[model samples]
Target: MDDTPREEAGDEGAPPGGILDGTQEKSAQGGPPPPARSAPRRKPGKSRDHSAKRLANAGLAITAPTSRALGSTTIGGQLSAQLGTVAVSDTRGSVTQISYTATVSATNFTTTVGGNTSTISKPNISYWSGPATAVSGVGVFTPGQLAAANAIALTGSHTAFAVTSAVGNTSVSWNPTIIVRVPSSAAAGSYSGTITHSVA
Candidate 1:
């Protein structure tokens, strides 16, 4: 039972120049060559601001005015400031503990020149966590003293400050010592007072 009337072959088992040949046919111009399109997919990249930065480096020099020393208790003439913090943490895979804090500003010590007036009790600080060398006393505000304001934590608790490594912008230095005290009834013409130092 086999009818001999068959002549239909447009795309099936018919190869000779493409038409559904064996390997997906390929001859008469692009057909099965456009199904391998895998070059149109890209959407991954968005992040900026490495983060973290704190710098305070300004003129600091207080040790004049007749060498400060009226009488009795005297320790005037002390100024230092070199705290830095520029970090990116690079990538932060682990180990991270960086801290910083110190404050001061008119906690005491004022002078209204003339009219009889004097001050000498709001200047005493000391800190040296890195790079130190400034004559008299040697930083640490006389043992890290701030007297008031409350905000001195250069490396206390909080993992004692740290900077293991992350990637870029890595800096860590501290040195703040400004202790000035004048007793003996501090009172004399030409007496100025103004203290302010902060970092966090």
Candidate 2:
């Protein structure tokens, strides 16, 4: 009477295998274990920089010369002439103002070999601005305000006398004198005229 289901008396070593081979396998649908994949947080490696600037401008210049030859005089004699130095330099970048004008071709003093004339007008010519030396830059003109006894009387109606002005970046100098008075009814040869200077 054996029904074939009884091996329980004193079970011998037991490894005849197959109840899913002694079970310990998992995950057909687990929770909270899918969020441990943290290897993608490495995006912090970038850099940059840029900058630039510039500003520049400076221009203008002037220096006048030509008047040094008046060798003889005597006729109610009174002479003084040595028209030299009249300098000005402007380094302009952003501030500027300039003015100087002087002219005279004939107020008197003429001789055509045998037709003499020297009956001067305008108090016998004299226009001066001598004594001003500031050899650098910025707003110049000092030394008794360009004095030669502060003279001004040069006419033949060739009027343009406003000789001084500068506000920024300016070098300056001065010396211009001409005093002649020989009108004892002057009548002789060798006489000429011309003296002009300008700036703006």
Model 1 Cα displacement at 14 (Å)? 99
Q: What lDDT score is found at residue 100 in candidate 2?
A: 32
lDDT by residue (106-139, candidate 2, tens digit) is 3444443334343445467666656664456544
Across 1-200, the per-residue lDDT of candidate 1 in tens digits comes to 11222222223443222111000101111113355655655567644333333112111111111112211122233333332221111122224433233333333444454465555454332233333122221122221332323334322222112333222223323333333434446543223333333333
Weakest 10 consecutive residues of candidate 1 by summed lDDT: 18-27
The residue pairs that clash in candidate 2, if any, are none
List of clashing residue pairs for candidate 1: 125-140, 125-141, 126-140, 126-141, 127-140
Off by over 4 Å in 2: 1-89, 92-109, 113-126, 130-137, 143-145, 148-168, 171-179, 183-185, 188-192, 196-200
What lDDT score belongs to each candidate, Candidate 1 first?
0.28, 0.44
lDDT of 1 at 165: 24
